[model samples]
Target: MKVQAGELLQKINYPSDLKQLKEEDLKQLSQELRQYIIDIVSVNGGHFGASLGVVELTVALHYVLNTPYDQLVWDVGHQAYGHKILTGRRDVFDTNRLFGGISGFPKRSESEYDTFGVGHSSTSISAALGMAVASHYKGETDRQHVAVIGDGSMTAGLAFEALNHAGIENSNLLVILNDNNMAIDPNVGALKEYLTDISTSKHYNRFRDDIAKVLAKISEIGPDAYKLAQKFEKSIKGTLLKRSNFFEALKFRYFGPIDGHDVEHLARVLKDLRDIPGPKLLHCITVKGKGYSLAEKDQTKWHAPGLFDKITGEIKKTVYEKPQPPKYQDVFGHTIIELAEVNPKIMGITPAMPSGSSLNMMMKAMPNRAFDVGIAEQHAVTFSAGLATQGMLPFCNIYSSFMQRAYDQVIHDVAIQNLNVVFCLDRAGIAGADGATHHGAYDLAYMRCIPNMTVSAPMNEEELRNLMYTAQQDNMGPFVIRYPRGNGVMVDWQRPMKAIPVGKGRKVCDGEDVAILSIGTIGNEVVKALNELNAEGYSPAHYDMRFVKPIDEDLLHEVFGKFKKVITVEDGCIQGGMGSAVLEFMADNNYRAQVVRLGIPDTVVEHGEQPELWAECGYNAKSIAQQVRLIGLTRSMQTIAS
Candidate 1:
């Protein structure tokens, strides 16, 4: 349990245990905690940097506040590792983000101290505000509400809305803006610049504190004099920094621009602010990957670096060095830049995921054309639509799961108006370890239902490139190009870009007994299943149904008519996914064939390795093969019955 020679973290079973330690020992505890996280994540592989950056803040907050009863909500839960460790999950910290183990993010189901389950960014303020308001209504004045959010997350409209509401309500709430100048990648937009100005302005913070001291003395003199001094302070704040006045206008008592690394300072600030009335804001300045030098230098790369040597800071090489395939995002990154070179009208946009979606590549190459619009999803879509209206072709890159936030923009701005905005949805399937909130399971269903929207999912990197290429050719309404996370199965994926016919599919392998149809990168798994089935003397016809919208009726007619036994496999939900499309096709044509549908069932998937999750959903290579073999068993049973 103990990490250091003296063993500080080993004794911390909960927040109370952490509180029992000497104030001086807290600094050592923070160091031990950081090392422990690095040691565990070096082997296990989880989100880095954010957790490391918040170690001091986490230790200080737990030490200052009466946690479980007080209510501490972490925005997105990326920085909750230290919180998890100190609050009785240290022994199980090694199981982070693994199947049937503790999650990488904070979970209400996992622990009582979690307070609220969060995955998406910018929800912490809103959630914590609600908790604060609830405590007020219940007459529980002792219960404190704290929302720890990142500077990048603050760019979202949701965070502002929460802050706005909290301000008007005048409730007891403390919002700690973890200003690390980065999210998953480096922070962007005017808000980031505004915060940076505040961070660097030492004279302003010092002068402001001096004014506060004079105001405190003015309060003792007389009530009227104190009010006059407060009014003067507001006028000076308005004149000095417009951004500082912005928070003050919202009725929040703004504090800090303080060193987040100092445990003693943070604890002191937090204890003083605990009694302060109304909505409070603490702007704690910290470096992303604070303790780790390599990570601090290249914060984006180390955001979620896979397995690595803790001491050497080098990525551990695999024993078996196979030919490395480019990650799906890398393909998008390079392809977007390539396409932008040809088309002057083409513009790239990402909602706070410059690095994650690989839009950073384009951003770096053509700074003017590509943009990281911060954590504003709805704004990003509408902004892209605005660009399309001005005769510019906008490629809006958003994670498939995250696109749910901007659904209205897709319907109203793009599809309804018939704009030529291209939606490049990365992480279009299981999304492996991050769990159900991150799964791209609903894009197929949601996108297909929309009118004038061409919903397409690529089977491989080649198709992805071609599809992206085709979407940018003309003002062909709105097009959605979705591919999965991680590397494509193909190694040599830099194929020439070609225009794929909209809503058309091609046969991959020929068969007779049963037909296997698939969509997305999941089709690669189907190919594996078919090859395995072939080895066992079972041949099934396989079609890569690229577009989910048009359903490829010409191909479906041939598939359903040729084979009585048909199976549809997809990486999304079965309710309204590719399987549903096939069923609809059969109903319209009245094709009375025994069709088997395979995909994610009507249940939430747990966080696990992709293969295990795919198997759990009954769509992995082996699972698909088993489903195909069922055709023979079913046919035999029917023959015997007849």
Candidate 2:
């Protein structure tokens, strides 16, 4: 059915509009919403399964809760598409995840209904509790606060910490644990088992209700009876559960292992919970990729379904001119597999990003050696450090942005000990569409500051492979080889990989008029810019300064002497980035040259396409050439003045 403009979704602009919807009408509305999401994502690809899994939950929440006023914070906001569509963004769904369009995740500025901006996982509970506490302080006791967090996210320590704090404070907060039994891949560890026990327990709800009713009856017997009833209820719950009362121990009133797909059931439960309060946790069981058959069968692949034939549920594989080398993550995955194959001491670790980090390949190849430590970035770092002490070459793969969670761990555990752990920092630059929270802009800045840490970024796939080999070989201190997301330069992998010299850079394009010092995956862009400059009757020297840490003094002095005008480009913040390093070096040496820094601005960059981000940051060929030409013209004027 073609989506008609101003039909079912058009009439409903906000949560208030949704409240007018009949309970029976919500089933059709959910269908429309799912189809709309499918239609939008079919063209503009994004997190498909996540949104699909939360379709009924999204509908139920909006139907029951008064949104915008009743704060609903979504942890790792990738699943907030249905929320966005329901809250006045259905018409613009076509432009989802595109440059200058609707974000893939919730943004505070985009909609008032999006109470908290979230991209990183396990933040909803803390944020929701903060809001709930604020509301209490302000004496807005009627306002409801709900946190919708995935089972995957619940694995993070921060969630547990928030639960602990909220429980103690007795904050008026509702935490909805959306358990899909999958976090990118099947969620591992003891928590998954605990959740399974909760979901499958048949008499749990009946027992909980009976206990609550008994407590209510006792409360009617007056103040003395109420105190005795509370003690009896706590003892009974403790004896019946017998397990580590995870949420309740943290002080949250645990409710449900409810059916997430059944919208009516979810609505009834949410409504009941709305009446009762004080740090409540609703555990709703959902299936990842709920509706679609293929997605249901293979949830991991469907997690972020690519452009596919909606009818057939088959992804369309596009063929390139020359079959390119796999992504940097794939190379890392394969490299680790090879290393693990040879050395039994090697262990691989990823923080719930098995697919994204390409650690699945390693996990499959060496099951015992590889681990998907779910959404626990801090834990992953410390875990690797423990492995390091036990004579294991622990290759910890995590997205650069996520590594922010373990900044203290990286410093305290790994760096301080000078452990020989390999930190494979993937997406260490402007990760397009996912936006500011996802962007790996500050990795260089953050990683560079850590003592006994060697930070290296590869210019191409070969260099990335080489760097990985070097990192494994060097049993010195902790080494981090940062690589950007997506395929690297489409280089030939058939060629034998060679190890790059550590803390060294190589000249890519030779010129005399000006020098362009470039870093990371942006080297290709810099090369293109230099080519454009040549076309415009100028020859600009280009150097791919692969390593950010150990300043290449010889290369810096040579480039500074050769060209009076120098421009530094990186896909990171200009402050404390590659450009800043160069500027600091020049200052230390007292070398005065006209320096231009091209990078992501100090402020947060919004969601957009990778190429669009590059263009916006003046890292694209045309933009870089324009800056060079401007500088050249100014130099010519200066020469004439002299």
Strongest candidate by lDDT: 1
461-541: candidate 2 lDDT, tens digit per residue = 778777877777747579988998887776566345677777789888788678999889888888787777787788788
Give lDDT for model 1. Answer: 0.88
TM-scores for the candidates: 0.95, 0.94
Which lDDT tens digits does candidate 1 get at residues 142-227? 88999999999999999999988998876779999999999897888888888888878766776655564555356467757856
Q: List where candidate 1 sits over 4 angstroms from the true fold.
A: 1-6, 208-229, 232-244, 319-322, 637-642
Candidate 2: C-alpha lDDT: 0.84
Q: After superposition, which runs of candidate 2 have C-alpha atoms over 4 Å from their true positions? A: 5-7, 205-244, 635-642
Cα lDDT listed for each candidate: 0.88, 0.84
| Per-prediction CA RMSD (Å) | 2.3, 2.4
